[model samples]
Target: MNILMMTNTYLPFVGGVERSVQIFTGEYRRLGHQVLIVAPSSSQQIPSDETGVLRVPAIQHFNGTDFSVPLPIPGILNAALKQFKPDIVHSHHPFIIGDSALRISAQLKIPIVFTFHTFYERYTHYVPGDSKALKKFVIALATGYANLCDFVFAPSLSVAVELRRRGVLSHMEIIPTGIETELFLNGDRRVARKWLGINEDVFVIGCVSRLAPEKNIDFLVLSVKKFLEKRRKVCFLLIGSGPCEDKIKANLKNEIIEGKVIMPGTVTSQPLIDCYHAMDLFVFASKTETQGLVITEAMASGVPVVALRASGVAEVIDDKKNGCIVENESCEDFVSAMNWVQGWGRKNNLKRNAINTASKYTKEICAQKALTVYEGLRRKNHILRNHSESTWETAKRLIKAEMDIIKNMTRATGMAITNK
Candidate 1:
């Protein structure tokens, strides 16, 4: 099987969407299928051994964020498309590369699957002239884009229901971003604590994610700080780095200097596995995550969690079973939830329940489910295009595609206005 995956972001950027692409691509290749990744070219060093990756030109650091704005030149992918002859195109975003996915799918008459990775409306802050209207516009645009695709992948049921509520009528499936279970399962808590120079006796409350504003880092830091102040032997282990680093440093300056707060910028692989195991409880406050991949990763390490009620977090947290899911966004509520989980510790089958939850979302399981869908969809769309397409039909399809996008914009405007 030849699979073409188009995403807005990819490695050497570490985020949920990038990790999802990486995990699925590796799994597909391991299962004896060919996968080609098409993403924006990064200034960072790409792996030298990569073969199936095609990087398009991009503008670096759009809006002071780590994201790259892709510049998709006309006919940039023409030659590769002819060579690869992808059976299906999977899009991980609703804009930029996502547009390319739509164009390519339409041109080649192949199946295109879109993953509703993020609620684009929540991220309008990155764009200049951010407004409620712009947010609503993006929401409608994403809903429209999902409808244009042959299928849609929702990372969680919360997201799936949300998309459906927003009018994404396309065939949809809940395929979560999975974690490598083996890595977390065999992690050495003692070793991780020793490496971080922390004693195993300390109660560590940790979270692993991109430290960005959209992640509600401010609320999380406040909650954790208050939670830690009451306990004499507690540590706040906030992993991952971003724009929020300086703010976190300032807010927890005294605690950090006193060694009560540890911010290890962007720890991955073994260190990340260790950090998860070294923790007594995992904490999250992001209201933006589609799958909350880190939450599951922590769970895989047998670390129960306390997270604010959000799309992905709610699905993963089983409320007093594996972890605590706060219903409101208040700092007090979040802190209280942490205390609640702290009381439970690794008891009352919490750790075992967390492990059970994580087991269901292993990389292998999610990938197999996706691969099965791809196989079925590919078989249904497996047809060779004619050497010469009719000019009228080509014109009609292209014009219609453009019109659909325009209509999406207008529809999104209406949706935004109505909701607002």
Candidate 2:
């Protein structure tokens, strides 16, 4: 099958959604399908021999982190769609690129599949005042686009539930984002620690995410401070960069936790996996995630996690089993959970369980499941289009019948009012 994948951001912009789309397009190409990616042009574009990359003009902005807002490139995109003639157009978000894909799919009369990769509502605070109104608008936009798609793919059950709550009653499928298992298998802990320049005896608690406000990194810092007030030997490692880097550094200095907190800046895959290996525990306090991909990455590296019970996080973590889940976002609760993990002396058991859980979310499994959804949509679209009677005609008749019933009810109420 020929597939066109659309996303607002792509390579050079490192995030879970971008990485997930890259993996999906890569796996689809490996399976003998022609895949084309349409993303906004960034500072640099990587050429790919396996799949085609079409970069569109977009506005680059710094919303605490780097991101691109792609403009309407329907002319170029539709021209490419005509040449490529993809069987399925899979879009990764409900923004500019995804909206473009929706319009193209309708115009071309092709099946469009959408994946809800991020929870935009959670980040409404970043938008100016009347955030509640903006959130409603975003949800309405999502509902409109999703209803037009052949099928909507949600990465987690929580996301699907939220979609329904927002009035998106379209056909939905829950498919979790996956990891590259081979890259995160068991390795020599001592070697990994040596590579990260960390001492073997220190208890290292770390987080790997963009240093942004929504991630609540400050909360993690506070939790670390609380932990240190009781115990002094623990260290914290932060492994990503964003606008909040300077603020976080300042806060760490002001709190006098500078020596305990380590910011290694941004690093690629291998170094990131190595960071996970060097850490004794992984702590993530973000509430904005639809699916915390780093949590699974850490689990795959045989490290237990401490995360808030937010969104789809529970789908991967079992509190007290793989790791501890803070039931609330309170600093005290987070510190208590971290202390509990330390007190249990069950790190080995937790690590083993986490690794076992991670095995279930490999890239191959995710790709296959997504392929199945695509096939199902294709068959459904084929059946609907090839039917003897037009679906539009059938829909019109149903609408007329409902209208007649309402009209009769109104007439009866009017007569009753006149008689009274």
Candidate 3:
């Protein structure tokens, strides 16, 4: 099968959606399918070694975010589509490139699938003007357009429910993004700690996320501060970089100076795997994640999670089973939950459960499920088209037979009248 993925962002830019597309496409290729990517060109130069990745010419960066605004040249897109002839087109966003994807699907008469990857309402900070009204409009616009797609998939049930509540009339499915569990499970924690200069005796609580306002990094800092008030042997590692990196660091300056916190920008591959292994617990304070991919990664590494019981986090976390889910974002509640998990660590029950939960969401399982959906949609499309054509052919045959019979009857009646 030939699959075309149209996304707003891709590699060299690290984010949940970008990573998800990469993982899914990789799996599809391993299964003997062809995949093509269409994304905006990055500010940083793309690697020359990369293949099957096409970049649309970017006019400028979209606002100040890492995303770019592409000119969407129809000629280039048409040429690519004509050359590749994708079996189906899957779009990772609902705007920008999404419109181009829809147009291409229509011109080719192929099914288009859209994944509702983010809650646009929560990301109103990126846009200027009346945010509230803009959020409402964005939600309506996204859902309205998604309903027009062949199918819609949400990474979590929370997102699916929200889409439905917001009046998304599309056929929606819940498919969480998968992780490479064994990579995290097998990473060397000792090496990770030694490289980061973290002491072995200290309890490490970490989170991997973009340092942005939407992520609510301040909440994590405040909660960690509350935890450190009584516990002196605890350290925090905040990973990744984003627009609000300087602001978050400034807010946590005292903790940084005291050597109680480390912000190591972004680390990938083996280093990333090792970081997850070095953690005693994973803490997430963000209320905006569609699936909280980091939460699954940490759990896969045998580190339990303590997060706010909001959005998709609730779907993945079972209180005291795999991780602790605080009902609110209050610092006191987060601190209490952390303390409880710290005590619960002695039994190792949470760690076991965390691993178990993560096992259910491996990359292979997720890719297989997604492939099933894609194949099913494609099969249904083929069946419907064939059925329509078969019906039309049968109707034509019947009409022709009826016309011949009428002509024969007319000729016979005229001969009988002449003979009489």
Q: How does each model score on TM-score?
A: 0.95, 0.87, 0.89
Q: Quote the lDDT for 207 in model 3.
A: 89
lDDT against true structure, model 1? 0.88
Off by over 4 Å in 3: 255-257, 386-420
Best by lDDT: 1
Which run of 10 residues does model 2 get worst, by summed lDDT? Answer: 411-420
Best by TM-score: 1
lDDT tens per residue, model 3, 336-384? 9999888876257877889999998999999898888889888987766
Off by over 4 Å in 2: 44-51, 62-65, 128-130, 186-188, 254-256, 384-420
TM-score between candidate 1 and the true structure? 0.95
lDDT for model 3, on a 0 to 1 scale?
Answer: 0.82
Worst 10 residues of 3 by lDDT: 411-420
Ordered from best to worst lDDT, the candidate numbers read 1, 3, 2
lDDT of 1 by residue, 1-420 (tens): 899999989999999889899999988999899889999999888889878899999999998888898996569999999999888999998888888888888777788999988998888888999998888789888989999998999999999999999889999999997778987898889988998888877899998978888999999998898887778788889899998799888899773436799887988888788888899999998999999999999999999989999888888899999989999989899888888888887784999999999999988999988988887788776554454789887778777877776787788879877855
Pull out the clashing pairs in model 3: none
What is the Cα-based lDDT of residue 206 in candidate 1?
91
All models, RMSD in angstroms: 2.0, 7.1, 13.3
